[model samples]
Target: MREISFSVQALTAGYGNIPVVRDVTFTLPKGTILTLIGPNGAGKSTILRTISGQLSVLSGTVMICGKALSGLSPAALAREMSLLLTDRVRPEMMTCFEVAAMGRYPYTGRFGRLTAGDRQIVRSALARVHADDLAEQDFLAVSDGQRQRVLLARALAQEPKILILDEPTSYLDIRQKIELLSILLEEARERQLTIVMSLHEIDLAEKVSDLVMGIRDSCVFCSGTPEEIFAGDTIRHLYGIQEGTFLTRTGSIELPRTRGNSRIFVVGGAGFGLPFYRALTRKRIPFSAGILFENDLEYGTALSLAVRVHSVPAFARTMETAFGEAEKDLLACQAVLDAGTRIGETNAANARLLASARSAGIPVWRTIHEQD
Candidate 1:
């Protein structure tokens, strides 16, 4: 059996005696990444704080490598784990390099001085996070993204078996978030390090994590692999989303489809109609979409943004029954918007729908706003 790197059993934690999160339990194998996701104020940070030993546990236990966390000395725990928290730190006159070198403290001599080897590790950590260029800059002067990278580097400098991050992607842009998560994924695979982090971007968490836990109302709401957790309306229920639709396949959310009768018909396929669908919904113009295979990438988006959609079996030829139904809807609309999806063998039904629209004297538009 694989060894468990970290395990929490029925843990409850919060400031003082009041518990914010309770009955949280999970076990992660070495080198696996576990992500915690929930609505705001759901105690994700409290769970992390308890596991890191910064907050007192009200009940239950956290074990690191088969040893109880409470029994471990501070120095010993530092050797086993490193934390990148959400708290902002403004260090006066401290260079980024100096900030990163602090991770070596647990291994340093009595003077807390960095030797040549320690300096090399700090530099390597900075480079690993693409922050080596910021090494000599004032830590407080850098951008939020840069500060996040430097903080991650500091955690890496510790060379611990487990890394704990609290919303590490908070200040990062899309590119920076992807880059940071990529580095963590590589490190986990190559170094056999365990990772536990909280993420606001459930989409990214689904893509990156080996295990995902959903927290709500002070307890573990759900825990499973992303595939298991993301199935059906689990995410929607988890977030209490009522006004919009959540796409499990793409991890994208779309506004509710415009209500009432659809005035416009869309001939969309091959994922080409997504933007048009969204635009129409925003304009509060009810629209119908058609000729999409059930497995088409745009199928989910259409379901979310269109009043009605006509779909056929994936990989199967467009059925005449489906086409006839779409033609009926198209004739009722004032205009037909062609998403300009590539015409291919499987999606030839879309082309036929366009021809039918033209034959019926309905204006055809390539863009949503071009409609008469």
Candidate 2:
């Protein structure tokens, strides 16, 4: 087993005498990533702040490398952990390189000037985050995403054993989000750095985290492996998501299913039906969908959008009974949509449904954009 890098024991943290999150306990093994997730105002940030020593712990303890946080000097703590906080930073007249170079303060001499090796480390950190282009740009002038990357580069320059981030991806686009997290993943693996961060993107968190901690109702709601935390209705209930469905397998969310009787029938499979289902849902057109295997990529979206759905076991041949039910639904509808599912032995029922729709004089559409 890997050495434990950080541990939180029955911690309660917040401002002043009040507690925002209580009884949060977890341990981070070397090179592991733990993510905190919850709805807004659930104290995810508070937990991070407390652990990073930016805020006082109202109760309990935080230990880094078996040493209590309270016992460590500021410089020692800085050497052990680095943080990228959500707090806005505006360094006047400083370039991005200067901002990032500040992270080496713990190792700098009294004069605090960067040595040649320190400068190289700063450059390497910027390159690691793909922010080398922004090095010459004025720190205050960069976009939020660029600033975030620079801040992360700064934290990396600290070369701490642990990294704590608060909503690090908040300002990042999808591509930047993936790139930044990928860098963190690589660093954790190669450097054996422990990572603790709070994220609003539960889907991304699920993908990157080894352990997931859910904060809710001023306490640690739950903590476990991603497989344990993301299973079933855990995510849905954690976020109090009543308006839509959360698909655990794909970590994708779908809007609430359209209510009332379905007027249109959609024949889709092999992950081709997702866009059509979403388009119909946006148009507020309640539709029925059929002949999807439980393992289909679009199955979750179909369940959330379609008023009714016909599905068979994953990897199993489409049952005749399911096809018959789908055919009946198709015949009752005035129109049918063929989502361009590939015709194969396993999904041959979809082809039959399309043919049946044509025979019944129900207009069959190859795409959602087709004219009536």
Candidate 3:
């Protein structure tokens, strides 16, 4: 079994005599990727700062590798852990390599001389971030994504057992964000590096981390594998997004809830439209269409919602003539009925279209709306 790298017990922390994090307790095992996720102002950053020794703990114990963290000197603590803060200040003239080399400051002598081993460590760190070619480029001149990778490389150079990051992907684009996260996961697994980071992107957090820590209402709500933390009601309460649906099979992205319409379909035509279509959208229901004229308003509305529509003649006037022209449309509705979809029509002339669906036992709701 992997050893526990960091353990927080009854930890309470904040700044200047006030506590933002209350009684937070969790143990992180070595080489595990743990993610902290919560709403803004939920004390996620406060907890990170507390564990990193940036803020003095008001009470309780934070143990790193069996040693009480509160008892360690600043230099002693630096040897065990490295922190990558969200708000990093870049040196105006330093190159990416120079910035990364700074992570070795804790291990260097008074003169800050880089030994052959130290130089090798720095070089490996740069390559880990895929930034070896940008070694001589000015840090301030690089894009936000490049700078972020450099900062991560710098932390890697420290060679600490534990790495803590606050919103590491804040400055990265979608592609860069995924690339950086993948790199972090790979490095942690390869080097047995224990990682804890805060993230606002729920999907990314769910994808890469072995454990997820969610903060809500000044308490630690839950901590476990991504599968356990991202269950349907867990996210609904965590983020307060009731419209969100967690896909059972996919297990990551939350889907937006689509309102299921009770009944709707039109043998499409022009000007015999607008009013009825507007009513359907306003009611927020599922709908279907068929036999539409090329320029029909009803056809346009159905297409917009991506409902299935059957194609037929551009015009149909009387019952016999229209039904004959719409024979294909009637058969197509059979597929919809097989799927148990409801059917309905607006005008009496087209009302017969609902008969087949009704004969198949699918419920039908009929109503008409006058356009303004």
Candidate 4:
């Protein structure tokens, strides 16, 4: 279990009259990586800036190590936390090593001479990020990904207990993104350092973060473990995605594309349709179903797949169509089957529909025995 560090209360700040971060409150515990995620203009960057002392808090309290951080000097704060923003402007003549060494300024003597320990710290930080080979290269000549890693190393050189990053993987290729995040995770685990970063890659954030804070409509709408925030409801609302399923495979979360028009009609109740429904979805085939009169495993599944539902009138005297509605559905399915569409059915009641399919020479699959 990690120790708790910062305890923020009703923190609010903005550029001017417009408040971006509106009355946000949260806690940061040491040895854990927390992620801030939301849409564009969700004030994620503002939160990072305010926490690192780059932007003044217009209201509320920011406490670090049980002390009020409002009046702390920027230099003093740097010794406690390091900030790595996305803004990249390389100086004309600075080498990668020189740029990374700038983090030592707060602890440097008046003469600005590098002590043996200072050089060792800089070297170690560069090596930790695998940026040591790029040390002698000119900052202006490096790629955006390389520059980001160098900056991260510089932050590491500060020896801060906490690290804050804003879109650290921005402008990096897929490989670089994974490498950079891997380095950060390693540092957090090895040194027991607290890390807080804002990210656009929701999937990556969910995978790496111990806790996730999501912003919506200028307020912190949700905050919890990654599993909670990345659940179907929370993720869909956060990203404004209308169609998709949150899948969990082997204890890992995935948001595979759920877009398609394979509207398969499943006819079964009492746990009969689960296997086919799951199989259709796994094979990227869209499906629907209905007429469930009571609680069934397939009922929840059909709802999850957004299947079209047509209920049968309960307390009916016979297992027959009500108000000719089921007859119309049968006709509709027959029309599709006549046009060479695939249809399936289960049990004795709907078995008539399958016989009709066979009569019309349409392929019908029976789940009477193999249904899960």
Give the alpha carbon lDDT tens digit for every residue of 188-292 in model 1. 998898999999999999999999999988888899999999999889989888989889989997887789888998887766788888889889999999878
lDDT of each: 0.91, 0.89, 0.74, 0.73
Q: Runs in model 1 with CA error above 4 Å?
A: 344-348, 367-372
Candidate 2 versus truth, CA RMSD in Å, comes to 2.5
Instruction: Write one digit per residue (lDDT tens) for candidate 4, span 1-372.
Output: 457777689999677656787888878777789899998888999888887788888889988767778767877887888979888566999999998998888889997677889989999999999999999999999998899999999999999988999999889999999999999899888997889999988888988898899987788988999988876577668866655544422122233434444344556566566566566667776544544543444455555663354445444343355324543454444222111122233223454544554676545555335322
Sort the predicted structures by lDDT, highest score first. Answer: 1, 2, 3, 4
Q: Which candidate leads the pack in TM-score?
A: 1
Candidate 4, poorest ten consecutive residues by summed lDDT: 334-343
Quick one: RMSD of model 3? 11.3
Residue-level lDDT of model 3, residues 1-372, one tens digit each, is 779998889999898889987988888888889899988898999999999999998998999988999889999999999988888676889999899999999999999899999989999999999988889999999998888999989999998999999999896899999989988898889998989999998888999999999888887877789989877567657766655444423444323322453245544455344444445555664555554544454454444442445544445443344454444445444233222222234233354555665676545554343431
Kindly give the stretch of ten consecutive residues in candidate 2 with the minimal lDDT sum: 363-372
Q: Pick the candidate with the highest lDDT.
A: 1
Number of backbone-clashing residue pairs for each candidate, in the order shown: 0, 0, 2, 0
Q: Across residues 147-224, which tens digit of lDDT does each residue of candidate 2 receive?
A: 998999999999899999999998789998998899999889988989999998999999999999998889877889
For model 3, give the 10-residue run with minimal summed lDDT.
334-343
Which regions of candidate 4 are displaced past 4 Å? 243-372
